[model samples]
Target: MKNSDQTFSLQDISPKGLERSRKLTHLISSEIGATRQQVIPFDRFMSLALYADSLGYYVAGQEIFGAKGDFVTAPESGDLFGFCIAEQCAEILDENDVAITEFGAGTGALADTIIRYFDGKISVDNFNYSIIEPSPHLSQRQKIRLSKINSRLADKIKWYTTCPSEGFFGVAIANEVFDAMPAKRFTIQRGEIKELGVAYDGENFIWEIIECSVIPELIRDQMSNYPEGYTTEHVETQGIWFEQFKKFMKRGILLVADYGYVNQDFFHLDRCDGTLRCYFKHHLNDNPFFAVGLQDITTSVNFSYLAECALSAGFAVDGFTSQAKFLIGNKLGDHIATLSVGDSVDAYRVAQEAKRLILPSQMGESFKFMACSYRLEKNMSGFADNERFRLG
Candidate 1:
């Protein structure tokens, strides 16, 4: 939020209105095994706070996943974004007849774009899509959106609360999904590392240092070089999730795009605080404890871990590149040209959105694209122009 241009009022943090704050607080304490004053690890607190049934941020009746929600995804930004992705997806599925499984399929706009593009071209009977969404509210919204776009396409798309039990083939995509997984927060304190946690003081939640244990080797490797007082976060969820997701894919590609860094860049020595952040309305706040369930709390991903996880889980690391390069390489120019901007105002707006998506100082450079393939060819349009290092 500090570096972002967007702003939101303190009042808007209450997504379900401030009335539900008590219910959220009560649910967190009950689900996380917290006594009246006992502390819970930050990761545990985050998991429970963001995902605890109907009481959590995503499920408990609030407008999320759009401009009306806390933040906007690239798909929602414009149809151009999803069209570019569909271009890549279409190329992958040209010969291979398979299902496209999308994790965190918010608003189903990407699916709409894919459907619109391949409507008459691809046989609807051969093509299928499954959205892995847990939130009933969001799923309902997706149904409405998909049906609005095209009822036939909606019929082809199925909603799954869990991964398909049978082995499947095709591409899997999760846009900005990994960053939402709960991460363990730790700080280098007095030459020793301490885990950051949360405790309720009857009136409010406060930060606390929970007992330390044998840290995950991944965390230790990165934190060892940081100076004392340096704070950071790490996640094992993507690796764990990949183990399950890959089971559904006998052969396909996994495309992950989110703002993240390689391990080396993630734990930069000069970074005093890791990339943990909260989004309420459009405003950014570093404190996850601020609005609890109402605000979205997330940390930047460590992409290096993802590649390692994919390899260990039997995926071949295919391509890794910046969002800008990926877009440029994947015919962003073509997609932009397809837009019909008649008026100067609309043209100017389109230009601004493209600039934000492709500019180095904006979302483009900060977000990265990683492709992990399973029994599929590695060379693809998304990474054709990934060679940014050679520019200098």
Candidate 2:
């Protein structure tokens, strides 16, 4: 756990933030009260904390990306990440009437960068860029930022609250998206599985144990071989989400980039505490009860489980590799080569960003890229080297 001591202080919160947090807490408490057990599953708690009507973290109109937000994503670092992704998209884009749908387009930075890079480069006549953004606040921000593009590129952008059930073909990108989806938490105690739920204590929310009978059989199969008091998360929603894609998507690839691990590492005996984490103003901690609506809660993805979902959805595992390898194979060095040595300041800036992106000690190994395709013929160039195996 990084920054375990980064606890939240009520005195440090602004009056407006404090008010919002209180309102959201009250809302959640009211819902819990309505329940017969006066408790709710952790996934339900997470959904309300992060995606409730108007008071949730995402839809509450808060600064949520880049330096001013709770955390910075790859696109916020620099255009290099987007440029590399754009190159990969260009390579996979085959049909004439194809489109690109990016799930959770945070700040629209990647969309802007990719579209700018694709201008005149993608020879497809009917190229469209669709963004499936759930938050109206973030959608407005994306519109403002993306509106600056030229008319030709600007016309290619569209927004939706959900993936179109009609489906399309081309590509789907989800960068740091699945980590935010609500996940169920459970623990093993005395050789018995128990659910970890949320309950209101009049003052704050606290953990409550429940029967594990409610957990699905699929999740139960994975909970074995763990010692007592071992806690972990399960995001069954990932598979459900994949099923939606399988039904709607005609034929295309889904690209996912997030910080996570394979099943062996994720469920290792040493990992007793699991990967659930909270972020507030760049600070990280294991506690999720503090500053409820003001903090960002996330759990590391189980890549092996994700791969299984892809396979069950009829999508072949096109590739899986570390972000470092994906970027290198996708020509990250080509972007570095464009830098002019004469301009030391500009060259240094790009070099620093590249280092942060691909260095082993930085975002490189922590983050991974997985591509699942349906009816795609060729392998993705970005994951040609060092393709991972033993995925579920």
Candidate 3:
């Protein structure tokens, strides 16, 4: 195919982009010799997708929420989603003064709602707020929104460039964070599954499937689950993330909300093309090569692997459920009940979106909720009877 489009492609990299790509190319060629010219590992591709200096989609200053951004997350559903999460957080706080550390908090919408909810339920002195955001652009946006809140609550808010220090205790929450991690994609050629890698292709970056000799043996061993002829892919970064989570969390809850499925369901024979997707201006694009650094790239999470990693990291699997089940079980219905007393139109609109968030056909069933903890004896209140909860 002709690579003539200048809308957004490898050509858009400009002078600085070419220099960076040349440096990366030299680094790869030196490490792996000429074979590196044909294929670069999936992890490297992920780095480009997310953190390629200025061109990376997440690293760049692009709007990433609501109808205008690349994609919409549950938090974009508005205060209803935030209120539901705050309700659960309040229960966890109980009598202790705890800090709420949110990962990849986009636009601080959720944080704003959380602060409001906590303010209404308890004294502001009882809470401390912190957000871990990597993008300088997004962090500035968060500061702008957060400044509108009372200075007392706003002052309590802090930002971290990386994860918090080890042995931290409190609630660690992430909304749609795990899905953004770089995932390794694989395809079955002949009878052997090979990883897809990126290369310079002399003119521009291109993908090539090659043997995965560099991946850790433990991760490579998991490929045994695939059928003899079936091709599969895995998120190699998920394991690394769990280890990081274990190191930071000494005793507290780790709540992750994202779109994913169990291993069996995720790698079924029907899913040949894999879960890789690109989003630009609210439109889903399958070709990751098209947008380069201007679009959002994501894949579904593997809950089974996450559960196993958490267990190995000494975390007790408190609960595994859908976002819908967790929200309803935690009393989203109760929140809805209160909506009728106010502006009925706005309340109804919020209620409708809330339903879409939790319904199986929409995001509810597709999105999952997984929680793990250390030193906590009781089960997570929000996920109780999670398996039995039906999608509405």
Clashing pairs in 1: 1-284
* Candidate ranking (TM-score, best to worst): 2, 1, 3
lDDT of 1 by residue, 1-392 (tens): 13443355556544446666668887666644545437787888888667778767777767776678889878887776777777788778764374688888877888888778767766667788889988787788888888887536557888998787988788888898898899988888888788887877776777788874557788877787668888998786777888998788898898898998887688788667888888887778787766667878899988888778888899987788889888887788877766745687767777777888888898899988888889999568888866423211
Query: What do the candidate models score in CA lDDT, each in turn?
Result: 0.78, 0.86, 0.72
Model 2 gets an lDDT of 0.86
User: What residue pairs are clashing in model 3?
Assistant: none
How many clashes in each structure? 1, 0, 0
Residue range 335-389, candidate 3, lDDT tens digits: 7776546787877887787878888899888988887778865556678866522
Best by TM-score: 2
Superposed model 3: Cα runs more than 4 Å off: 1-35, 202-204, 212-231, 388-392
Task: List, residue by residue over 1-392, the lDDT tens digit for candidate 2.
Answer: 23586865878788999999999999999999998888999999999999998899999988877778889898998788998998888788864654789999989999988887877755546679999999998899899999988747667788999878786888899999999999999898788778888998999888888753477664578677668888899998988999887876888888999999998889887888999999898888888888989989999989998998899888988788999999988889988777535488888888998999999999999899999989876667898874567565
Candidate 1 Cα lDDT to native: 0.78
Off-target runs (Cα >4 Å) in candidate 2 are: 1-3, 95-98, 339-342
Between prediction 1 and prediction 3, the one with superior TM-score is 1
Cα error, residue 179 of model 2, in Å, equals: 0.5
RMSD of each: 3.0, 1.9, 4.5
